[model samples]
Target chain A: DQQVKQNSPSLSVQEGRISILNCDYTNSMFDYFLWYKKYPAEGPTFLISISSIKDKNEDGRFTVFLNKSAKHLSLHIVPSQPGDSAVYFCAASAFIQGAQKLVFGQGTRLTINP
Target chain B: AAGVIQSPRHLIKEKRETATLKCYPIPRHDTVYWYQQGPGQDPQFLISFYEKMQSDKGSIPDRFSAQQFSDYHSELNMSSLELGDSALYFCASSLAAGRETQYFGPGTRLLVL
Candidate 1:
């Protein structure tokens, strides 16, 4: 049972353009959401995260939008750079037992073409 | 700028062999999590520890066991390894227990021959 889903397996965009990746979740119990960027052979790096109470969160060049009613979230990168090309994973956090575990999506490979 | 640390970046073992992987959480982090990622697959949660105790369990197999030490370092021990056990093992640490962001280690790649 995949509680988190990223329907798009891959995305491509030209450098200096905007790139948007979407994610959906089936579990409403998730109280927090995060997006992680990973490169080949390396661990995923923390990108950005939003609380379930918030609708939007933004960092320098990255923004995350959450739609609680739809159980959907999206990450947008403005003026994409070549370094932005990597696998993006959407993860949801839910409290279980005494700890919180992350449910990760299949991931979408974002390719920024230079 | 401390990150989670994992030892034995790569391990090659034969079937029925035993192996142990170690992880050191970032300073002041109180929770540790284990995840397994196979080729072309998303990471799967295995287990988690909080304050030197097992707090949660997931899809971990019976042949696997883990423990968190007083120093906050953790170890995952696998016995009677199988071919299907080959994968990248990631250790993540969080500041607290619930609703916290986890910082992951570089991961240990295990190959069962």
Candidate 2:
């Protein structure tokens, strides 16, 4: 069962434009969420995260919005750059599974075209 | 300081063979995790280790196992590998057991024939 899901397989955005990726989860028990970015032949890097208690968290050019009622979250990148082209994964963690174990989404491949 | 590091970036093994992957966490880190990423798929959690003990074992098979030592490094061992085991395995480290930001390694690509 895929507790976390990213319906979009891929998205293309022009450089300097905004890019938004969405993720949904079925498990309400998940209290922590994280986003990761990965490039070809490389491991995923920590991008951003938010707790269920917070609605939004922003860091530099990246912002994560969480809607607990909807069990959905989104990552927005402003003025997308070519370096932003990578696969984005949304992950959720529950206390039952321990904090270190994460359930990842299918992943959304984002491409920023100049 | 350098981020999490992994060794033997690539490995090829035949069926029924064993493959071992290693990971070194950042200094002072407390938790280490193992994940598998097959082609066209996201990373799947394998297991987690912390405080010199096993913390979590995800939906992985008995063939897959992990070990942690010295608070700095960990290992993932696969015994009697099958062709389906071909994939990229990743190692990640976090500050503590509770909710935290995890730094990841470059990943090891394993091919089982």
Count clashing residue pairs per candidate. Answer: 0, 0
Q: After superposition, how far is residue A19 of candidate 1 from its true place, in Å?
A: 0.7
Q: Report fnat, model 1.
A: 0.77
Output the lDDT of residue B14, model 1: 100
RMSD per model, one decimal: 0.7, 1.2
Best by DockQ: 1
Residue A39 of candidate 2: its Cα lDDT? 93
**A95: Cα error in model 1, Å:** 1.2
B1-113 per-residue lDDT for model 1 (tens digits) = 98999999999999999999999999999899999999989999999999999999999999999999999999999999999999999999999897889999999999999
Candidate 1 global TM-score: 0.99
- Residue-level lDDT tens digits of model 1 in A8-96: 99999999999999999999999899999999888889999999999999999999999999999999999899999999999999987
Q: How accurate is candidate 2 locally (lDDT)?
A: 0.91
TM-score of each: 0.99, 0.96
